[model samples]
Target chain A: MSTAAATHDDHHDHHHAPTGLKRWLFSTNHKDIGTLYLWFSFAMFLAGGFMAMVIRAELLEPGMQFVDPEFFNQMTTVHGLIMVFGAVMPATVGLANWMIPLMIGAPDMALPRMNNWSFWILPFAFAILIGSVIMSAFGDGNPSAPNFGWTFYAPLSTKYGPDSTDLFILSVHMMGISSIMGAINVVVTVFNMRAPGMTLMKMPLFVWTWLITAFLLIAVIPVLAGAVTMMLTDRHFGTSFFDAAGGGDPVLFQHVFWFFGHPEVYIMILPSFGIVSAIIPAFARKPLFGYASMVYATASIALLSFVVWAHHMFTVGMPLAGTLFFMYMTMLISVPTGVKVFNWVATMWRGSMSFELPMKWAIAFVVLFTCGGLSGLMLAITPVDFQYHDTYFVVAHFHYVLVTGAIFSIFAAAYYWLPKWSGVMPNKTLGELHFWNSLISANLLFFPMHFVGLAGMPRRYADYALQFADYNFWISIGGFWFGLSQLLFLAVAVLCAMKKGEKAAAKPWDGAEGLEWEVPSPAPFHTYDTPPVVK
Target chain B: MSEKQLSVEERNKRTLKKLLIWAVAMFGFAFLMVPFYNVICDITGLNGKTSSTAATDVPEQVVADRTVTVEFITQKGDGISGEFTSETKRVKVHPGEITLVHFYASNPTSTDMITQSIPSVTPGEAARYLHKTQCFCFDQQTLAAGERKDMPMIFYLDPEIPRHINQFTLSYTIFDVTERVAGKNNSVAVN
Candidate 1:
């Protein structure tokens, strides 16, 4: 509309990208880097999912079926680490990288070279992390991989942790560096590179949520780095930062970790809020209800995340007031979260609604994520959490929020944008099949965890009491079914990229809005050489 | 204030610098949390870390009618090659009364050792009201190889301790600081 032909010629000097490996190795293109991130995330997802399979296989009959308990501990530990750091977090960052520039009418991410660096750091970090586990499993003398859980509680991590703990610590430091750089890039890009007339409020929800997420990343990642640094010192340097006899306390570690950790969970979900906000409206044929409130709610949730970290430590002997304060603050999160859920439903209320693949995913996200949020609220009650802490119920709550909430929204975004990215529509039948299978299996996989947890099935154990046998049998079945169903999604995505379906129009969905839709399908390698006027 | 007048590249650099600073500040804040946690826990009487020094303002009169159960527990911390136990597993004392407890510590290894006892009072809200006029934990103890010592700790629980907290445990975790203290003194000697 604004002389795209003219800008095309203007960027001709920068048009020819390097060939093959060099293109990826030295890519400064946001789209290229974003693809790298998504693929990396998928690979990590498979790796982490493989670990889940191992865990399930062992728990199938609760008699130590497939692997020994030590190997089992390694699987659980690395599974959580890979899924959280390696799968969910990067997938969201991938979406942010791909969509933010396109939505904001910017030429590219603000610091493109830095984007490349961020994407590249991840594979090496993960290599170090996984390598440690492999060495522990195979190597002699039981140089065990980090088995102290992903939280890496002290005393266990400091005194009893295996030699591989150092490697785990180093890997975490690298991941922290990568995340901080990525966050900085997002912040700078959104802050400075929007089209001339695109004011803060007028920008897409994806960009807004990402902007806040970047701030959270910038603020909290360093704290995590510090936490690990102290652990490192405690392990090797004779420092007693978490050693009580030497004037430091292990409880100090939890305080520092959950401080970074609570906000980190929000970092995974806030963008899901953005992705769902965009998709629900497009399918509902209605403007998002309470957009301003959505913005306020996201900010309030971020603010509240900082204060409510200690709910994770209710059993750690906090002062009664401290416990109550954390509980109240944690419950307060439900209000803004409810606002978000209500707004999504309200937007769909009385509107001409379509249940496309993306919409189906978004709809499931709303309902299932609310269930996760409700369980989270139950866990927030100090007294209730005393019963549920470290149990399968806690595991159930997170997997629902993370898998259904974050990953489902990711699926919604992928389906919503694949046409634009690949220039062809995906096979709707296959897409729907993938969606339904995933939804049902995911529920089968996670829903019963709440019941099992309430029945006192402690998590992270290779074997459970015989009473949990039936539920676990079903849960394992659900896990395998859910794991296998993702292959269908992979097939759909690959076929779409191969241009198998109908050629997508510039705007694929009739109700979709934003500068992203205004661009031609299969968005050119470079765009917005000259920033388009927003108005 | 004048950023809008700058070129986009320049403005981007400025924001980058600011964000980087914020990141550095947050990193520092993480380490700062260690001290902040201690201060807050000390002030609010949480995390079970009782006072490290003598209390001069303890009340003169003891409330003989109400006897509170003060449980004594001794633990040997990591790397501590020693046996630590309390002579009295539990004691009943009136609020505001001076109470003495004996703890037995022995060095088992074939070398001189220095150890420090760190005390924590659980039902942590009562920590502030439990005052120590003197404690072996106040200074590191030196024990020759196989030497056993009976150390005395004198303390008082203020009548102001919350009525609901009729019982609390005071735990001492003894850490072997022979290497740590020797390291410091060696460094000092070299300096």
Candidate 2:
């Protein structure tokens, strides 16, 4: 290992790296590509977040206040699309690019050039998506952006969707290409480039989770591409794949979309599980409890994801047997999910634990993510889902999982690896401020949604009845507060990247493990060009 | 598994090739889901897609001991501004007994409109058992402007329809397809 680092430093000096914007534009280096992906996802996050602000502002009162219903729908649609595809997915991929090679003691991703292509495709894909949104607002009498919720259920998407939907279809196709290529790169890297002694069982949980997540991506992204492509033909080519008039069923759209979509959700979170698994053990100063079980649970969750997609469409007039089957299958996800939550807590049980900035976010993720999971279980009941379907309760459930669960884990990983990535520790005081403000405001933002949703408030509406006004007002306040709190995170990231903090040792966290810590802090421009023997 | 002797570059290439093939297969699989969905629905009688043609499998001896109520309902699908109503709202008959119902549709619009009626049976499991011997839903119906037409459907419930099911609803949704039909006609004329 020591010899590996020594050679890494010499290699860094002699690599003759490309400089300036050219370095990023045509970069094949894993760390540089990882940086590009992270920054792109963050920018998307803010753009999507701005849309959230618009939505919250509009919903701040009962009637339309700022934007019309069409624009409001566009905001909600694009915000969801951006956050899921543009923000969370890319960020996880970025982490994979930066850390997988280091963790597995490999030189780089299997396909370095393809890695560049995957990361590069995302910006253009989002440009088309967001461009459509803009064109909808200003284009010559074209229909407003894909106002059909993120689900873009058929008939609405195929029959009545505006011209922007065509753009949406194209953008989705590009994004699918990017994701599939990225996933292929991951699968190839993990399978081919692991250090000789680093057995599959010995790989870190982050790498293992990512391995599973990549498979899920490969399997489902194409299905999504299929769904959108069908929409494309149905809209322009008049194929009627989803039109009942031509012997097609609208329910088929739900079937296909959720088939991709259910696993797609697991894709967003499995990486988070990996992140939290890494962080919790480090902070608690203990090995993760039930390591083998965690892997099995993740696999089972992924497997179960395929069967439970029908749960999302329970209200779509499925037969009684179908309903019960989906309901039970959806509930079965809880077993694996519960195993993960239990393992995280059990790892912390009676262990010497420290609440660093990263630990704080990890702890929040577990608690809030469990809240999201429990609500998901509630929604899994076919009889009850009829009451909660399409309601704000569903909205609240996902936000708790996504914002607190996935986004929080992203923050945790950022803080945990900031030193390793940037060569400088994030400022302690600023980190604390960011953590506390986000946790509280985020709760304030999402917790009340459950009550409001239960009290008969539907989601995706520009306005609501007067009875829900007070809750809406406070929720908007929390939204703004939570939105502003992320600025502290930005400042911390920028400052750390600028090297404006205390210098970090190779192993900044006392309990941290893996070859990532074996290298110097900031991880060098390149390391492990010659893979280290894992043992 | 046996690639131990191969170089890293070769193994990586092999793996990448396999994954690319898998991705293409899954993409093809997604499209395959359409036909696969139909096959499954046909088998399970799910999604309520009734058979379009006449049924020849009805039992000679009716299930006289068992009688089920069949309710008729009509609704408009998207883009259908035409008026439709079921003449016979409800009927009770023994399984395997032939039953006939009439539905009326009127084109009030100034333009001649072509329409198709899609039939669905409720308690979806009952769909396969409800055989339509003759139905307007079997083909597109062209109604001239200000014309009203009475469409009759002949059907019979299968003798083996689940013993627990005593009643079911046969619903038809009418969709206006004037433009689609016209477009096909124009393309044919051009050819």
Candidate 3:
């Protein structure tokens, strides 16, 4: 895009947005790639959600009816892998793609070609991952897809693993490469391309959170790449990285995997911290109560993440000193996390607040995420973890944070920004219906798992004891209803994109602030052809 | 464009190049962790790979006031056919006193085999304190078909074995490395 072309096309739709499939296939625009990332993630969510339904259905009556034990394992494993890599992380990146340049007043991302490459690579990565699952189910040879849980712990992943593990390893490498590229784009755009006067501290919270999340992605994704690579060699080559018979230790695998795994959990959620930080303040009509503290808190959480990974392995018989060190360090994370939670409520305290669809999701996030955090704190205590480990309680704790916390924040962001992208208001009734339907049913689904988990209903089991049948049945019903509620979200998005509602003005929310609000609704094909001064 | 604008372009280009290079370097760093883990194990002895050498000083052995129970455990690798058993299951010894243990191994299969026994000390911190003067683990054992042998471990637990534990398990898993050795030099290139 040249200066002359940019000038000609900045406000003229006729001169840009190349028609048909070429618009997506050959596009260099950040907005287009962002849109692609969002739709792709939504599709992955539906696919993964279907797998969750199969799992819940099989568990409903304590005897496996819908799927056999093997397929059940596949369902849980692929569902987690797809949701984390394909759904949650990509959606966050999608939002960053659309909003960061606008929030920072940059003309576009620093490297547009690489942005397109990152977005396009996701389809092939997911294809191989999902396709391997299909191949595993039907292939004449040993199954290929990863069934060793999303954690893919060794022995199951290595020495005794199936033929398809090699493909899983390759898919993970592709995903890692895509993530690292996406992170590089975000970091470079934030640092080098911010418009004049948009100081690091002055940029919007979403931008700040993405900035830190990008750093985290760069740091951990490569470590994961290393981990899977070792797994690959151990399985295919004679190298005994995780083979005990070969003088290699299996627990060594856990130490390396969780090193990446811990930061990875944060990589999923920290952006939600940024998202709620943006939505709560806007709806509250107040400057964030502790913006500085929130930034530092996020940084502290990121730094502490590297040290607390061993908390996940308490049941693996870690040395006592290692156990105590990780336990206390993991608890220390609560302090910074508490700061973030308090700042959100403080921003809303006594303020003239209005609840929009986005605000509703954000509010739900604050309460639900705190509940998740408390359970996480419980898990961090070394002695108690022996009981909770691999139980439904652990499952409930993560889904509460991951589903209700991270995914809900993504829902809020989509609602908040859908009008800007499509130049029309999301149908309010459908939005609210989606929120309440999801909220009530998701609680019903996840909350009972805690009780049964404490009662010793081990997670990853295809069947439960007869004593646990009632809770499992209720939980399954909740899962189906929660899965159905998402169709409302899909409808709201498609209709808004089709321009079914009232046309939006440049600014939709009355209390909104930031460079994003300064742009026209249905942000033009090109914006900030020359950077807008942030001041 | 002015000189300042040119410099901004130069700076952005340099930083972008640096980041791309860093991404490649990070990928390399992932492969590095394989060797890196072994380095840490060498330094900290975290994996509990006990060294079977006696201390030069040979200080007078004084039995501690408390005892740390040592349990002998054994397992045969799936790919190997052998009857591996420990002569004794458990021994109670005061810390700082020497103890001797024996293990029996017989090649029940028709083929000759080279067997390597990998040892681990549980309550892992105990690994550092359990010292060996002579143990079969120092060398791999080669047994012909129908051959049997007795192996010995001479060792003492250091007084430093922490107070919280009264018992620890030392287990050895045996792997038949005949084919693996012929396949390659098969020794774990660990430090």
Candidate 4:
């Protein structure tokens, strides 16, 4: 594996990987850690989905039927927290770990040991969080998990909160640390580790999006840490950072939290934007439409995210000036987001389009995510938000974005790259079944939520009024169907891992063009030991 | 090959150092928000976290003959039922003239209780203009069981307060912070 004085072909041998449990415990390999993060995220997804099941089951008949009201509150809180931090974020990082270096022609991440540390810290961090949730539920009078919502509003979270709030705060702190460390590694790698010919513009859209997303992470994650730290001190250390009774304004907490939070929404979706950009062009059998504009659009969206934090607080009675400013700035996000969507559509206009599984998911991503985006634009109107705030409309909007947009892209990425990574092609019928089931049921699950919300059904409630009954029942059915449909994807992934399908070629997708595709199927344990010459 | 490995190691160390520094600095900057808010508010007046000083910034005091009425409203806390009343329901004072008011607090609880009052002015327009040089809200009031205490607040409405705000209500919510500052002596640690 030595590289000095070689003609850049030193990666001819298969390196023997360490066997058994120790391999995962200490392995710094990008592929291994990527797989671990993906699996861990899938498990979290299931956990969050199970919580959703409880929520939907409770909502089925308009009154409390299954769980107690306090437990219902816990389910909502943990569902949002786990899905955001555990499922979506970790899965994105997993893809980045496996694909970023491969796309950029680097042998590995710039900081491999730190990468392992980043991955390892997450399971324990989430353990503390979920443990607190369980303790609150069953600790024989111990306070249940922090139930003031994932935002953990002041006073409700600080003054009246259970002792488990401390655990939630500390767990969030660890999650923030992991995110920052992962971000820094991505930044340094993208900046200093690219192959000689792969200039910033020439790099894949995935790399470009990750570069921006990583910078956003570094800038905002610390603020989130600071916020939770202040919450910790306010709860225990006699600090009145958010205490209204002690001269501190509770509104101040909202200001600081959203400052980090608004950017975080982009941190999750920007990479999906990148993946969509990649998939649309590849399956269209054409060069990307307006690649440079796509890059600029991503950058502008990131920049605009900072100023629009107040849109989330429109219902908090912000000053008219602040409301208008945030309203317009939030509306401004639609422009760049529009350009990205238009670019994807334009890329597929009059080209050799294929409806393969990955493309199917990508196409669904564009349409359904646009549905989410348009609803988001509706939410951006400050006056309109007054009616929609704290309602299922907001819930519907984000699920459309996160589930149909981000999670769909994750599945698309898996299908697009599964052949290359496993050296085995998945069953197409199963893949399509997975896609259609997820797509249709996800809409049924989320779309009716908009109606119930508009009809004044409040969110996070264990029971609903009689008028909201029919939609809730249908939404629950959709929820069950969507939950069951995920098994198809799981089975397909398992079969691919077991080499139960056809042997994949070196370049499985003919239109795929990248340094990754240049490598043989089931990319060797040590790829490009001598970095490939990317032209 | 070993030399190449050494160079990679050195580069990673450099990046790690830079990143660690940035994380620390951001953390520091977050805590700095306490002071930063004050400094920025001083310039922009965006937040009304008014601080009282010995004297007003204006050299000329334009005391007006026109009177403005101020009403006092009190909110009592749980386990802190008390007879909290002002010396009078209303005070009419000329702008920029010092006005003195008295508040009476009685602790009906069997155990000694510590209480804090949070103040806000209605119509909110003259909240910042109504500055109290000495208010019971500036310190926690501890009363023994069945003990009644008289408290005084001395303040002046700034002459520059817009005349449209002719009347304002000064309301305070008395919170039983008996548990918060229970162990601390000298509870008047003003921020």
User: Best DockQ goes to which candidate?
Assistant: 1
Q: What lDDT score is found at residue B24 in candidate 3? A: 69
Error of 2 at A513 (Å): 0.7
Tell me the DockQ of each model, to 2 decimals: 0.51, 0.48, 0.44, 0.35
Candidates in descending lDDT order: 2, 1, 3, 4
Expressed as tens digits, the lDDT of each residue in B52-119 for candidate 4 is 34334432464666888888887775556888888878988888788789988998778998888777
Tens-digit lDDT track for model 3 on A1-535? 2443354355455656677998998777888888999999999999999989989989989776877787788889999999999999999999999999889987777778888989888999889888977886676324656778999999898976667678788989998989998998898889877877889999888898889999888888888988898898777667787887666778788888898899999999999999999999889999998888999999999999999999999987766777899999999999999999999999999989999999999999999999999999999999999999999999999999999999999999999889899999999999989999999999999999899999998999899899998899899999999999999999998998799998998889988888988889999867777677666
Backbone clash pairs for candidate 2 read: none
Put down candidate 1 lDDT per residue, A261-310, tens digits, no spaces: 99999999999999999999999999999999999999999999999999
Q: Is candidate 3 or candidate 4 better by TM-score?
A: 3
DockQ of 1: 0.51
Q: What TM-score does candidate 2 get on C-alpha atoms?
A: 0.96
Candidate 4 residue-wise lDDT at A484: 91
Q: Which model, 2 or 4, shows the larger TM-score?
A: 2
| Candidate 2, CAPRI quality class derived from DockQ | acceptable
Off by over 4 Å in 3: A1-17, A139-144, B1-9, B28-45, B52-59, B64-66, B94-96, B159-165, B186-191
Q: How does residue A386 of candidate 3 score in lDDT?
A: 98
Return the clash pairs for model 4, or none: A136-A144
Please report, as a residue range, the 10-residue window in candidate 3 chain A with the lowest summed lDDT. Answer: A1-10
Candidate 4's error at A422, in angstroms?
Answer: 1.2
TM-score of chain B of 4: 0.70
Residue A16, model 4, lDDT: 53
